[model samples]
Target: MTAAVDTRPDTAPRGIRRKARAYVALTKPRVMELLLVTTAPTMFLAQGGVPNLWLVAATLIGGALSAGSASAFNCYIDRDIDRIMKRTQGRPLVTGEVTDREALIFSYVVGVASIAWLALTVNLLSAALSLGAILFYVVVYTLWLKRRTPQNIVWGGIAGCMPVLIGWAAVTNDLSWAPVILFMVIFLWTPPHYWPLSMKYRDDYAAADVPMLSVVRGRSIVGLQVILYAWATVACSLLLVPVAGMGVVYTVVAAASGLWFIWEAHRLYSRAIQHVAEVRPMRVFHSSITYLTLLFVAVGIDPLLPF
Candidate 1:
C-alpha cells in the first residue's frame, strides 16, 4: 500500500511537469549541443591540454544556459514566423503548450543566471562576452537583422562565434590569436553551414516572410555563396594548424576535412542548384556539422600527440 501510494502523488504535479517540459523545449536542445561542442574544444585548446574538470563543467553549464536563454527569447520573438514554418510549428509557444509570458520570464531569468554563473566561476571577461553573445543573438540577430536583409546569417554569425571566445576566456581569461582564429573559422563557417539549411527551408522562409539567402538570392546565387564561404573556411582552418601550435595529427585531420568540405560546396555549385531537392542541401548541412566537430576535436587532441 505504501509503495503504491508513493506513485499516485504524481497526479497533482503532472501539469507542472508538462509546463516545465514545454519551457525546456523552447531552448532548442539540439542546437545547444552543437554550440557546446565548440565551447569544449576551445577550452581544451586554451589549456594546451585538458582543463580542470570543475572549471570545464562550470563553463559548459554557463555557456549552455546562456545559449538556451538566447534561443528561448528568439523563439518567443519569432513565434509568429515559427508558426508558419512546419519545422518549428510544433514548438511549445507555437503549439500553445507554453505561454509567452512564462517563456519571457524564463528567458530573462536564465539569461541573468548564466551571466552571474560565469562572472562568479569563470571571469568577468567571460561573463561580459557571454552577455554580449546573448544580446547579439536575441537583439542583433533575431530582432534586428533577421527580417531586414538577406545578409542575416552573415552578420548574425557573430553570436555563434562568441562561444569559442568565451570558452577560451574561461580558461585563460585573456583573448589570443588562437581563439581569434577559431572564432574566424566558425564565423566564416556559419554562412555555408546555415545557408544549406536555408535552402532546405527556403519555401518556409518565403512563406514566413523571412529574408533568408535562399529566398533573396535564389538557389544558384546562394549556392555560389556557399562555395565561396567553404573555400574561405578551408583557408582559415588550414592556418590554424600553425597558429594554434597543433601537431601533425591535427594538421592531417583538418586538411582532409577541409578538402571534403570544399568538394561538397563544388558539388552544390556545379549542379546548378535550382530545384529544392532534399538530398543535396541536407547533405551539405550534415557535412558542415561533421566538419566543425572533427576540426575542433583535432585541436583538442593536438597536445596529446607526441611531437
Candidate 2:
C-alpha cells in the first residue's frame, strides 16, 4: 500500500498542478467521457427534442461525480493489482499520488454528493439509478466479480449502461421500453467494446491474476465472443426503430455503423484464427468507440429530424 513520496515542497506551483492532475486521473476521465456521451443523447431521446439546458448540465455533473466515485473505489480496491499490471501501474493509487485513505474518503464523499445533487436537481429516480450504478460498479464488479470470473465485464457492464436509464428517468421520471432497449444495446456492446482491450492487455490481467476472458480463454474464443456480442449489440440498436419509431438518421446510422462494427469484429476474429502474432485487437477497440458515438449521435439527432 506504500508509494514513493514527493520530497518537494507542497506549496510549489508545479507540485500543486501535478497533485491536481493526479486527483483528476483518479476519476478515469476518459472512461467518464464515454459514459457522459451516452447520457445527454438519451436525455434528448427521452425528451423527443432538446432537453432543458440547466437540467442537462445538472445531470451531467451528477453523472460525472457518480462515475468518479466508482472509479476511485475501483482504484483503491485494485491498488494491489494496479502495482502489478503495466496498464494500471501509473494510476494515482499505484503511483502514490493519492493515499489509500484519501481515495476511500473521496469515493464516499463524491458518491453521496452525486446522489444528493441529482435528487435535488434532476429527480429521485435519476438519483437512485446513479446510486445503484456506483454500488454495482464498486461492490459487484470491483469486489466480487473482477478477480473471480471471466464473465465479470459482461454483467459488470450493467453499471456503464445506467446513464441511458438515468437520463430517461431524469426527463420522464419513469422507466420505459425505449431506454431499456438502449440499455440492452450498451449491455451487449460492452463485451465487444472491452474484450478487445483485454485481448490487447492479456498479460496485464494474467499478471494481476484476474480472470478476464482474454486471460482465461484462447484468443480465438474471445474473438468469437466479440463477434457474437457485436451482432447482438447491433440487433438491439435496430430495436429502437420499431420500439421508438426512430427515423431515417438513426436507422441508416445504426445499420451502417453496425456493419462497420461487425466487420471489425470479424477482422479481429480472422487474425485470431489465422494465428497472426499481432492480431492488433486495439483496432476493433477504437472502432467500437466510433461506432457507439456515431450511433448515439444519431439517437440525439433523430428526434429532431423534420420527417
For this target, which candidate reaches the highest lDDT against the unseen true structure?
2
CA shift of 198, model 1, Å = 0.9
Instruction: Write candidate 2's Cα lDDT for 221-296 as tens digits.
Output: 9999999999999999999999999999999999999999999999999999999999999999999999999999
Q: Any runs in candidate 1 off by more than 4 Å, and if so which?
A: 1-10, 273-279
- TM-score, per-candidate, Cα-based: 0.94, 0.96
How does candidate 2 fare on TM-score? 0.96
For model 1, residues 1-307, the per-residue Cα lDDT tens digits are 4554454556758988988888889998988998999998889889988898799999999999999999999999999999999989999999899989989999999999999999999899999999999999999999999999999999998999999999999999899999999899999999999998988888999999999989988678888999999999989988887787788988998899999998998888766554645437877889999999999888888876677
- List candidate 2 segments past 4 Å from native: 1-11
- The CA-based lDDT of model 2 is what? 0.96
